[model samples]
Target: MVHVNPVQVIVDPITVLWLNAFACNLTKSLSTAGSAPAPYIDLRLEAIMPRLVLETTHDYPLQRDRPSTLQLQTTRLLVCNYRSPDPTAPGSLAGLTKCLERLQAGEMAFGSDFPARDGDLQMVPDRLVQHTLGKDHVQPAPADVVASVPDFRRDLPGRLLWEEPRDVVFIHMDPFWGDFFGTSAVRHRPVPFIDAIPVSMWVYQNRNKVASVSDGRVSDLTMVLHVPSLISLQLNHFQYLFLLRQLERLSEMSALLTLDAERLLGAAGAGSQCVSAALPQLDISLLMPCLLSSKDSSGGDLSVFPDSSSVTSFQEAGLLPTRVDSLSEPLAELGAGLSQVKRGLNSFLSSLDSALKSPDDQSDTMSVMSDMSSDSDSYVLLNLELDKSESVDPLFVVEGALKRVPSVEIASEVTEDTHSEVSLSSAMRKRDVISALTLRLGRVELVHQGAGLSSSLKLNMRHFAAEQCAAIGWDEFQAKFQLRTKGWQGLDVSSPPCSVRLRMDSTFVPVANQRQHRINIREQVSSELEVRASELELALLMSTVTNLTDFIEDEILPVPLPMELYLEHIKLRLTEDRPPNNITSPGVVPLDLRLPAVHVTRDGAGVFTVQQPTPGGAGAGTGPSGSRSLVDVASSFNNPASGSEGELGRLRRRCQLLEDQLEQRRGSEQRLSQLTALEARCREAEDEVLGLREEKEVLMKTLSYLKQEFLRLDTAHSRRTDAK
Candidate 1:
């Protein structure tokens, strides 16, 4: 098997000529079939291949045709630099275009000589080619060449020199550096020179300088192709705004421009001229005012709008007022009043400061102290009067006045010891009074501490007493006092009354009565259990009877035995004289009588024997008396109305027979329908045959008359020939 391998070759200036010659010779030798024998060239050694590099000149080896079987495949096409004598001429691209047209086999790419001999051309290393072709294979530049070449200085289009028609035109501009297009020369002017090409899409990079064309100038300039294809001009943020401004200036010329704006800004900055041009187009007379308000409200940068020129332009257009109106004299008076108030406040503050620093401050302090001393004396006097009022009890005062009466006079005959004793008793009574007062005052507080009352409730109660005591009537107060002192004597506040009653009842019930009640309940329960036991026994007996009946009807009656045997078994059980449980007392009784012994096989055959019992009274007979097959019994059982057992079998067979007859009848009906259709078709065919026969007869008659006419014409022609 021959192997085909893809190989890429890089051809530089040094190897271009020699590699081209070698490719040409190899093509020639491979094309001449059978000129070189296979034995002369070792197949294995010939398989070891080398890269096939071709030059970019007119004499490249791909121009020649080679045999299809040749294993060589061109993987990469590297075109070297080709320079024309005149750099400015368009025809200089012809050679490179021709070279590209010849390299149609593989990935064809173009590269220029870096560090051009002319200083105007900048060296931009083709990073894509260098990574693909390996760094060592791509020729390196000399040390004298400048490494830092500005993007704008690079003559990208001039170096490649291919001015052939392009589907897309990419015009990249560097913002920091100026290019040959001279975009940076006139900063405010639109770059109108770039629209010469009629490409489908015009791509501008970095800055959208071309979109600043004035409306009148844009109408005069012919930029777009008039084909049916969609022509788009891409612009950046600033260019988009400029296009809108231009559209505003020349609304009639809108159909001529196709602008595609990417990365549009929410707001744009424009010059005074641009804003003025766009005002009418946007149909917003207050556009500048709205923008200013939005800027002020948002506190955004003023740079979002155009420079100071826009404001001046707005003034010039008479959209803004040039001067402000003055206020009236009354408003001016208000301002003067406010100034006077401010001065008055300052004067008052200065006077206060001076007063604070005066030496007469000591006299003022002495007067303030004397006034405070007099106020304290009055406060003490008020306190003394309140104490006198609180200390004077009404009952004591009334009793003292009564004692001062003449009838209440007391004798002055008391001894010294009696006086001492009376004084001690009086002192003890005072102590007791003080203690009782304290206890009464602290009663609610003590109750709150012991009753777990919340602080909020205690405070509310205290506040309620202090604020609402006068609102209470005398009767209500007496009632509350009586309840607190005497009503609680019989009340059980520790537990609920119902629970207490229940507890008392539990303790007071007689134990003997409870025992007797439990005994009576036990007796009643025992009687109910005995009744349930009897009912259960009756149910069990009924279930047993039901099960036995089902077993006899389903299993015993269905056995393939004569009905006489079943009747005999029933009779034997019924004729027993003893109780049913004692029927097995007389066991194994034998008699000299004959009984039919039956046996059945899986094939539905029954064997029967009539056994004659021997004189010794055994269950089996000594000799075979008679043997008979059950075929005769089965034949009798096969009768339709033989017995209840055979009735179901007969009905099933009858149903199957009726179904078979139904199927046959349906088949016959279908056949009759088919025969009817076939007969109708046959009659139609016969009628058609009859019609054809009549038509055939008519045609035969026409042919006979034509033959006769032909013979008559022949005779007339012969007679005419004789007359001539």
Candidate 2:
């Protein structure tokens, strides 16, 4: 019971064939059962079966006549692979249209093997039907059928006449299927589907001829324009313009327009103009290339076009807008000023080139002078008058005026050693005058203006030794003299002369070392005078001295002199008799005129004057005044106690000097100790050398004795050998 026999089943050829046919029939029945009638099933099955075989071989139908009544009742999906049999043959699409009519098909679709060669075959049936219907004088589609089609769908409704060729609603012309047939027969002609079909959408795979669509029927059609194919078509300017216009019309008709291109309808040659002009009317969202490539196309360079009027037209058409000029006023002014300066600099350079070529060319120089003169006038016009009540500084006003004046270059050929008398330019002379006045006035505001002048003067003075100028100092180039002789002669009256004098006390001349002592005394006096002068200037500004002349006479001038001079003058006055002019009246009794007399007076000419004691009356006053004028002078040449703060200050100074001398003496003692040590070491070395010389002499004597003994031995040995 458990043993199972292996069944041997064999299949016959006829049975296998029958099973295969039944399976195929069942599949066909399942696929077409919904739309097909039961009685016409066999005819529909036969029709569809032959199509599958014909597609692969691309063979024509054996029976070229109309279908039977049963086949007509069945729904048909006729796929025509429109490969033009003969391109030169007229009415080439007639056979395809007649075949669709014989089949009584409501819908037709086209496919291509080689899309580029076969071109757009979807429009072939439409164009053929239009030619037939025009001859037959047939009416177009009814309003009801046209209105039933949605505006967004790509397909339009078929025409009312049964004899008219049905619109080829769906197309797939992929080159992967088969080889190319040829260019589309209806490519250049108007699309006939727009007239025949009111609710039809046409698809193109290879090339697009959107411009070939009739302008009248453009509103009825929904075109899915393939932009890549459109570009490949290489349409001219007018074609692009026409296509854009048709798209605009379709949009107005509420018909759907889709662009299937990858990026944009790229412009070639004159097509760019059309693209630019048509961009505003397009649905920019669907046009990726237009969106990306020309996002700023509205602001593109209008100057690239030859005709300005065309650019204006484009602007008016809303394709482009005029760019607004938005420069700020201040920036514009700055730009203009920079441009003017550049022009002026260029002109000046050119003039310089010509002037350098010919030294005698004075034209450029004259023009420069004219420009400078004009600038000077402008500077004068721009001068701001100061308020008198503001109490402004005079020096500051003078500096501001100098700053406003135009600067000029000065040329000179002066050498260092050889005094080649080079003439100064007018500008240089003017600058020198200004510098001299500034120095004489001693104003800080004028320091910058005089910097160049001071540098040039110092450069000239450096060639000579200081000793050469000892007699005159730097007075040969006196600031006052230069100002007076130059253009600043009138300024001399306004500015007081800078006269500085150092007066030494007469009590301190040493006849033996008079020259050297005088030099030392003069230096000390000058230093003291400089310090006192600075103090006086600060005091004049800060102290309660109403009259500067009186202040100078009482404070500055008398403070620099030694206290001994004051005491000497007082003593002389006390010893001598009063002058008769000093007697006030008989009753007044000369009012003790012996008291320390200062005798300060303003002369009749308003010049300050101070009276000095008679030279004979004061013995110390009889000596030179250049050596003992100031407090330092008193310390150097007179008693150390004189003009010092007190005896304590003198004592402190003396102690400091004694300490310095003590240090120097200690250093000298250390040097002497070191020298004594070195002498002792040298004596030891000399003794050692003498002992070495005695030793050497003994060695020499011993060697001489050895040589004599050797000579005797040699004589004895020779005598022995002779005996042998």
Best by TM-score: 2
For residue 412, give model 2's deviation from the true position in Å.
24
TM-score of each: 0.13, 0.15
| lDDT by candidate, in order shown | 0.25, 0.26
Q: What clash pairs does model 1 have?
A: none
The digit string of per-residue lDDT tens for model 1 on 1-724 reads 2443544454343354345445555645565654542221112111222343322222212211111111112222121122234634221333223322322211111222111111111111122122223342322333354456774356333323332222111211111110111122123223221111111111111122244233211111111111111111212122223333332333211111111000111112111110000000000000001111111121211122111221212122121111100122233355556556654655565455545554453232221112445446432111111111133422211111222223423455432222211111121121110000000110011000000000000100010000011011222322332333222232222221110000000001123433224222112211100000000000111212232343233211222321111000000111111112353454322122222232211211234333222221221222243222355456546864654555566577779989999999999999999999999999999999999999999999999999999999999999999999
Candidate 2 has an lDDT of 0.26
Cα RMSD, model 2: 55.9
Global fold similarity of model 1 (TM-score): 0.13
> Where does the lowest 10-residue lDDT sum fall in candidate 1?
275-284
Per-residue lDDT, model 2, residue 514, is 34
- Report each candidate's C-alpha RMSD, comma-separated, in the order given: 57.4, 55.9
| lDDT value, residue 202 of candidate 1 | 18
